[model samples]
Target: MRETPDTPSPRSRRAFLRDAAAAGLVTAVPGLAVSACSGAERTEAAAASPHPVTPAASSPAAGLTSNGYGRTAADYARTGLTPGTVQQWEDGFRTAAANDDPDVFEWWYSDFTGDDGTVVSFTLSTRLDDGFVPEPGEDRRRPRSAVIVTDPDGTSHGGTQEYDWSEFSAARDRCDVRLGPFTFTGDLKTYRMRGHSGDVGVDLTLTGLVPPFRPGTGVIYFGDTDDHFGWLCVVPSGTVTGSVTVNGKERSFTGHGYHDRNWGNRPFPYSVEHWRWGRGSVGPYSVIGADLHLREQYGSATVPVFLVDDTKAGKRLVGAYDTRTVTATESAPVPYDDPAYPRDYYSKVHWTYHDGADRADFTFTDTGQRIVSRHYLTSPTDAQQKALDRLGIDEIWYTRYATDNDLTLALATTHAAGSGTGTLEAAQFGLADAPPRTGSSAS
Candidate 1:
């Protein structure tokens, strides 16, 4: 994930640090830019590539036209976007929003699940709250780091820390990022991470087993030219070997790990309503899936992304964003702490993907162990709470859970079914006024 021949010139380090001090937020870097090519241009680019990626399967003859999002294959065909292609510089930091836009944010996140049932996860971010848009001159973008460690006994330990902007620096050419005492640096194939917050600490190395991946250009547009979100799975599934320290006690572990990067300039409450994202390995497959629901103004589209790799065959079975090839369903309402908000979130989700003669079905059920539950408004004033309520932002919650997974696959040459364990995340930002729940708990 470092600089390649395609990398643009990076911003001056001195200027970045100086402006960071004055503004207290990590704005866009000089070389960070988004490609807003026209449909014709994108088509031309696709035609030029030696490997022209396309949807895994043709549209179903008589079923859902779009993926979870209301986008049909024709829509993607018009935009010339698919669920493949990984630009060399896509894994680096993307802070390309206007300097004065408090909505701009970026983060690198990783999690490891040990063979002995322990889980360790951490994140280094420019901002901790996705729903809080700061006022002009407000200093709220200090570099933030958070860690969570879950022991085999189901106990979780970790905390969040914020540091001055002076302590933050990241390379535009690759994935070299430092915040305070923590560091995360790596190439797309391998990574080294070391950090600590509160009583938990981790020093780990991750070796990639699958190549880096992104859906199409890895950028999801929101009906506007400049409004979009970017995502890249630098390490879809990897081998993690490292040491974790808790309460001054250290233990060594070998396990599986996953890492992904996210960056956007649009406020969460105004853009995304909720999303279900998870990743794991089952049988001979390593899989990642997500269901993203946009807000009403953006046509309330449901965008689905799913990827499946056949480790045994050493090839990809499915990498798709079309409804005919990928779809998802969820049930079992998981009510929020605030009673006034609707139970729009779910505790269970099922994803299905079909490509040619290969197919995969994955179901993730929450084990009822909540490792982290964060409320954006930790301490809100009366007036501020009122304003948020008027905007229908009942409560913004971010929750991570330990999950059990059941998977079945039917490929051209193999058929298998198995069960495993993994991690799942639920993010609710603007679901206060969402429609009434319809699905029963029985799926």
Candidate 2:
């Protein structure tokens, strides 16, 4: 099954591209700063004429530590660094993360690289299940679940499944959820994912190396509207012990694991056109970071969110603001062998991070990156579905870069600097407008 969005509400342009993004991995030609698709950006507004949905004023419970969080919706409500921004998780998958927010979206993501050049990643999010609003007759959910595994040989394959609302289940109080053949069960300390993909499958367990990283109320508000992004690095740092199989041949991988969740309602392209996200284990220290933009309402920073963690100095929540900064200097444009994907915004990025007097710089060279697998998502509303259906070709190219980098991490006085392997994703979501395809036509 293809991964698609739960809402059918079309934004602008063709609804299919937005809908497609909701489901899974898509590759198309696009660029940053330029419109990635023929889509329109919507100005979000709250229903003052509103529903009785909980307000964003709630905060995590006092003294409730991040590691103590569980699958319960309330556990999440009490997450983040700020109080009142959190909300309770309810039965069904959506409530556990998105609750009653419209344009609702969320995901459970994990990834790890084996010592033998093998790379594996997984995402189980709002696309995997449905229902942020409580309704017995609401079955607007489309393609519900997703699983992708890139094999050691660079071949990528996985599965996306949609279930009847009656078939999907989300534990009312914990992180126990099942949408089709994908199952995720976890407490604060550890989590396990078991996925099925035809003849291939992945069963992995991840144990946290640090507590969950909650920034602010985990909500980043965009402009005056309710269009916002919620991010929580649940497993900011962790160790992996699992087995992956391809056509019945299986091998266990012992390496570092990273998991996080992100949710939003508005079409992503409308927010910011492009972004670079990455997480990797460099020896004993785990690293996770991202640099992205979300227009003006996101404070004074040129880059709304620029974060990096060595995983040893706890987590840099909202407290890390002002002091922490990242400057990404694009070295060069990445070339795509796939002519259909003409955009090459992917670059060799050099990032310099600063926290007060401490400084750490790392360059993420675009090397050893390739096409492993792909997935899809669609618009939710019937009207949007029809809109998407008319778009013909799907969304743009979303590429992943696994780089070899030398990072220097300084905390207070001590510094850890070394060369290690890391993974970064360069995705042109066409988050705004549609740019002309730049490469050669496919033969």
Candidate 3:
């Protein structure tokens, strides 16, 4: 499923290309500036509008500490944030009003060689997942495009290419990236990169590729199409392929396997979902897990999950965990024309995860982020508007300081429980921060 915003949306050609150029490693854009209002009340206006419908018989509540938030839909409307798409379902997969706010999801990994933060390489993947269920019966082709921009003063460089299956399992992805200062290369099948931070300047490389399976996979993803009760699965397995480069050195990788965030529910007290790090002789594992509980001002509880993986085992294990910090870097006041909110904006978050063998620490400082504030009409009675809310950061900046980095990882389902019951494996080592993938399915 693909979604293209026909209503002239904001697009930054330079930001897109700069992100692509930092394919092989970490690319840090300037942190986005946002409004820091004192005594800022959490209102529906501050968040995406809710969908309208006969309220669910009961709403699941997520139990977590309040960040001193006290406001409802009414109070928020008083603020500038306008309500757009809102839909409340009487009986739906997940309760609450479905808000169709424009959102962008970007993941970045910066791998350092032997502590001391020396020599870095990173890969940044960005996507826009505007919320809307294809207008019920509307199967219109969603317009999508990725543009690469160069920093003329900084000497930007990167590559562009797509892959086609040469044989059933034998796949080949083509990419052309500029390696060093003012150098452009084309059709480079295999390459590797290594470099210092300031000495290197990177840009974007656009592709004409269609998203597989889920739409809005980039931004706010809901339950999976196959199983309405569970969370959405974006990169299921062996579907995404790209290479990373930094400074003058680079590396070519299959980026095999898949990883996803599950937004499932749990009981009270255990309200926050979590993902942590673990190790085994088989492969380094990161758990994409979370804790679910009830919130102070909600009917039921909500489950917020994240993706966690480490290369101690053969496959970087992933599961959910508790403890998350979503810092809204670019919180603009409501009303699109508001001068308080900046246009080229984004968000950043800090989270922690643990699993016996290792403790995972992640500080995601994502820049160049934006979300669509719109309304959703699930049904005639279910009309609602989701206000502009902060989305995921462009970069998943993280650090895995383990008790035993040599423990190796073993794959388990990204949302599975128990031990010795996983199938994924990690193939890259030394660069343990990079997410590992496998051919097996972990649902």
Highest TM-score: give the candidate number: 1
Question: Whole-model lDDT for model 1 versus the true structure?
Answer: 0.65
Model 1 error, position 52 (Å):
24
**Best candidate, lDDT-wise?**
1
| lDDT tens readout by residue for model 1, 30-121 | 23223432211111111122111211112222122221322333323322344333443455556732323556678898888898988888
TM-score of each: 0.75, 0.66, 0.26
Per-residue lDDT of model 3, residues 1-443, tens digit only: 32235411122322333344456322222231122322111111112222221111011121111221212232122111122211111011121112121121222222222112122223322212112221222121121112222232323343322222121010111111222222212121112222223434332221211111111111111221110122223222221233334455544333223322222111111111112222211123333322232223332233334344333322333333223331111121122232422222212222345555444443332222221122223231221111111111111111221221112222334332222211111111111222223322212
Worst 10 residues of 1 by lDDT: 39-48
Candidate 2 is scored at a TM of 0.66
lDDT of 1 at 155: 88
| Model 1 regions lying over 4 Å from their true place | 1-85, 96-100, 130-137, 312-314, 334-345, 378-391, 432-443
> Global lDDT for candidate 2?
0.51
lDDT of 2 at 80: 19
Quote the lDDT for 415 in model 3. 38
- Alpha-carbon error at 169 in model 2, in Å? 1.6
Q: Which ten residues in a row have the lowest lDDT in candidate 3?
A: 54-63
lDDT against the true structure, each candidate: 0.65, 0.51, 0.23
